[model samples]
Structures are given as C-alpha cells and as structure tokens.
Target: MHLFSLTCTDFAAALHQGWGKGMFHAAAIYRHVFKQGNPDLAQVPELAQAGILTQELQSAFNVSSPAIAAMAVQEGVTKIVFSLAGGLRVEAVWIPMPRRTTLCLSSQAGCRMGCAFCRTGALGLLRNLAAEEIVGQVYAVRHGLGRAIDNIVFMGMGEPLDNFDNVAQAIRVLSDQRGLDIPHSHMTISTAGLTDGIRRLGELGWPGLNLAVSLNAADDELRSQLMPVNAIHPLAQLKQALQDYPLRKKGVFFIEYVLLKGVNDSRGHAARLACFLEGLPVRVNVIGCNPGPDCLFESPGEEHCRLFCAWLAGEGLFVRMRSSRGQDINAACGQLGGPAH
Candidate 1:
C-alpha cells in the first residue's frame, strides 16, 4: 500500500481504526485494506490498522525454509533471475552476457524520481521496504528458479539511495554467513546520483561493492530536467563527492549515460562531456535510451553513440557501449518495474 499521504500518527490511527481483539483480527482488516499482511513499526495503530504480522509472513515466505527459489547453484555463463517489486508487479531477467546468474533487487514499492523516460520513477514514490522485504525478493527468486542467485543489483524498482538504511541493512542480512551469505562485493547499488547518500556509503569502507550512477546527461541543465535530484544535489557537488568516494583497489564508478538523439548527443556535447571528467577514475557505460510512453527523448543513432564514447575515450577516460540485453522487455539500465503490469 502507498504510505505517502499517511503520517506516522495517521498510520497509528489506521491500526487503531478498528482494532478489536487479537492480532489476527487486525491482520484480516489490514490485509483487506492494504493487501499486504506485513506489519512494521510505523506505529501501534498503523500496526493494528495494517493488520500485519511481520514475523508470521517472514516465516511464511522463507525460500530456504521450503528449500525452493532455486533449481541449482552450479556455474553458468547466464542465470535467469527475477526483478521483484511490491506486491503490485515484478520483472524476471537474466544476468550479464554469456555467463551469469544475478538478480536485481528492488528495495521499495515504487519510485519518486518521475524521470520522463523511466517507468518505475514515473510511478511516484511508495513506502520504504524493510530489510526482510528486500531479502524476501531473493527468496522469491530462489523459489521460482529452484536455484541460488549468484550476484545481485540494487538497481530495480525504487531509488536505493532513498532507502539507504534499509538497503544497507538488507545487504548485511543477506550477507550473513548463516543466511544467504552474499558478500558486499557481489552486490551493486545504482542511483540517480544521491550525493549525501553516496558520501554516507563512503564511511562504511566496504570494498568491492560496485556503484552505478544514472547520469543520463552530461551537463547540469539537461540533467536537472531529466533527473529532478540533480536540482537539489547539482552535478558539480556530485562529481566532487564521487571523487571523495572511497574506492577499494582503484575501483572505478560506473557512469551510466543513456544516449538520446536530439538531446545530449551532439559532437559538441560529447566534447563538453569529455571535459567534464578530465581525470576521474570512472568508466562510462553508454546505454541506449529505451523509448517509453510520454518520453520525448529519442535514442541516439548508433554512429552518434559510438562517437560519444569515442570522444570520452579520447579524453583518457574508460568508455564502453553497454549491450542492449532484454531490451525487448525494457530491461536496459534505468528501466525496470512500474505501476502498470
């Protein structure tokens, strides 16, 4: 359910709305209303109104409990995985080319980015998901495939940086030696460049945890228009913050630039972008813009895309064109879950 309009006390009041008797009674009402039988510490009343028995549902959806969500964990060039979303919808996909089995996990119900080209961000923001729910996605995937997921990407539904604490907590829980035990290095967190959150991540000193910044545009003006967060954070400060980001063993942050035809794709624009990252240790992963409904931006021509990468490479920056995998399913970078199935 969407909690945007629900205040803490409002949530409390909902639980207390018709709370009469045992937890199951409240659970029944919450299930009927929210359609999710999960309870959180939003407030006792909200707990009551929501009628969620968190512990109960956690036990119920445990993939390891049933030994499902996994067919096998053997080595493979490519492994199929699902992009789990809120109860509303989900995306099933495969990992990197040739050989891979990694699932991208969504830590929230919906997104608030409202990026014109993105499906999930356009859905507006939903409530932040708890660590269990984040990990629960893995469980669902495991059960679906009856095999273990090798790696994970936090580049799914919502902005992971928006749900920093829960995202970090989920990583800890999933990496628990006794539990899923996926290391920090194996998981990745992609963002639309949340400077504050990125700074916070630097303090943890977790080596090998990959990061991808959704920098669809090269300059500030276009970036702010395409990504609202750019207005508040700004590209200058973001670039500096990224430079300060502690990278383990010369790690390079992935600068994901989605190319569009008329916008941010001209040779002049490419040269300007090359100047933007003169000495940064970064890799440009040029992604093809997946045309979405209501998006005015068109994908750049193949030649222009190549030239853009070439320009950046001439400036001594590592640049590469990202292969369009699952494009038919709209599974390219920054494309994932949404409201409408």
Candidate 2:
C-alpha cells in the first residue's frame, strides 16, 4: 500500500483511478516521492478538491519511513536496520567510496540458502521482502546519505534469486528515469547459483544489469559443502545458464569467490576456478572471507589471498582481491545477520 514503492506507471494508474487525474500527475508524483519532496495531497488543493485523495487511497498510499528501525555509521559504510510490517527486521549497508557510493539491499528478511559461511543463513528463512520493501531500502538510504546512490548490489542478507519477482520489480523501479534514475549497468544481482532465476532474468533480456555468481568453490563437492543451494543447481547447470545468458556490449559477468583460510584459497582451487571460467568473459573478484562469530570460517591471510589471485592471474584471468570493508561495524560481506549494531 506504500506509494513510494510503486513504479511511475503504476502510480499514474492509481492517481487516475483514485482522483480522476490522468498521466499528468505521474512526473510530479515521481519527483515528490524520489526527489524528497512533500507527497501530501492536502498540500495540493487541486488533488484534494478533485476528490483524487480518497479516504481509501489516502489510507493505502504512504510515502514515509515505516520500514527503518535503526541506523548506524562506521568508517565510510552505513548500516541500516529495516523492520518490515511482518515484524521481521533486515539489514542494508551503504558503502561510500571515493569515486562512487553503493548501497547493498536485502531481498528477504533472513535467508534459506544455508551457505555455511553466511551469517544470514544462520537465521534461516523468515520471509521475502515485497517489491515496495526492497525499493524502500534504497529510498531510506538515499535520504540518509543526502545524495543519490551511484550503484546498488543485491548482496545484503538474503539469496536474491529466491525472491526473484520482487527483486526484479525493485530493479525496474530503481532504474526508471522518473524515479531513482540509476542506470542498469550500475545495478548488480549476486546469486548463489539459482539456475531457474538466472534463466528467467536472461529471458527478460534486461541488458546492462550486472550479474555476479557466488562460486566460492569451483568443484561441485566443495561447493555443495559450502552452499546447500549448489546441491540443487550444480556447477554444470549454472554454467549452461551463464552461457545462454545474453550479454550487452562490453558486459563482463563477475565471478565472486570468497577465499576461506585453508578452505578454498589454495593454488589448486584457483587453477580449477580459472578452468571453470575458461571460455566465459568474466572478471574474477577474490574476496577474503569476512569472519563472524556465527560462522567458524576464517578469512585467508593477505599472503594467501595474494597467492590465490596470482594463480588466477597466471592462468590469464583478470583478478582483483577486494578487501573487506566496514569490518568494525560488522557491515562487511558475509557479516550481516550477525550480532552487531
């Protein structure tokens, strides 16, 4: 019922139905909601006088902060706690870099994927966030940052593909020019190898949106042990899905490999990963595991991480070892759903 969550087209329809106003109100409403303007119908005498702001519509349409419960800032990253209407709380992280600011959104309250190293999996599946809730996170973050975000990642506290519809709708809304005005290329959806969702996204032919697969382990057996979702959709099926996906010009898919200490950080594992991505146009991002008390997995040392990236680079693969950010605030990768502010 949140008006801030609706797409421009849908909001226009609602305006026409409620107040007899046509598409003329779409742009104004979009600006009101996304541009941080007042959305009160009482403030606009025309809509109130025309009976466009009906009691039912007024009750249903709200453009306020109902989802945010708490917020904390650490380093350059800001962590927000969003309390859904269903009584479940989820976390979102805002990461600010020198060049660009990126916000990480959660698709679900907790998670069902059960990745052994993920803290969110420890909480199990609570519920999938509605489209409005998913988009609402961005709205909340934008207000907090006092500026629009440059990038967004669906890699917060849940498996995004499991909640595909809402996530996709959120993406469309975020990329809409009338709304957040974020480009598709600036958005990324990271998944734990959900082949069905990948196929659906590819079928939609939404070019420019980035895709990142959480392929922590190149081998099926090791992957299954780390992520239970892999057992359902193995590497073979996932690889086929990636191959079938249509990529836009200069679009290179991302392979996100979390280097676990003595686990998936070996030179052999790196070689296997290079072999697995042999023919695909991909850039490998090696992240050292961000350890939390919820998971026993320890992050690989800087030397081990360097060695892994070196091995992949030796195999002629583009590799970057990304350092974990906001560790002090517990806002780094794989640290959500843990005991932190």
| lDDT of candidate 1 over 130-167, digit per residue (tens) | 66567666655554345457788887778888999888
**In model 2, which range of ten residues has the least summed lDDT?**
37-46
- Top candidate by lDDT: 2
TM-score of model 1 relative to the true fold? 0.73
Return the lDDT, model 2, position 98: 91
Shift of residue 88 alpha carbon in model 2, Å: 1.2
The clash count for each model shown is: 25, 1
What lDDT tens digits, residue by residue, belong to model 2 across residues 214-276?
999999999999999999999999999999899897788899999889988888898899989
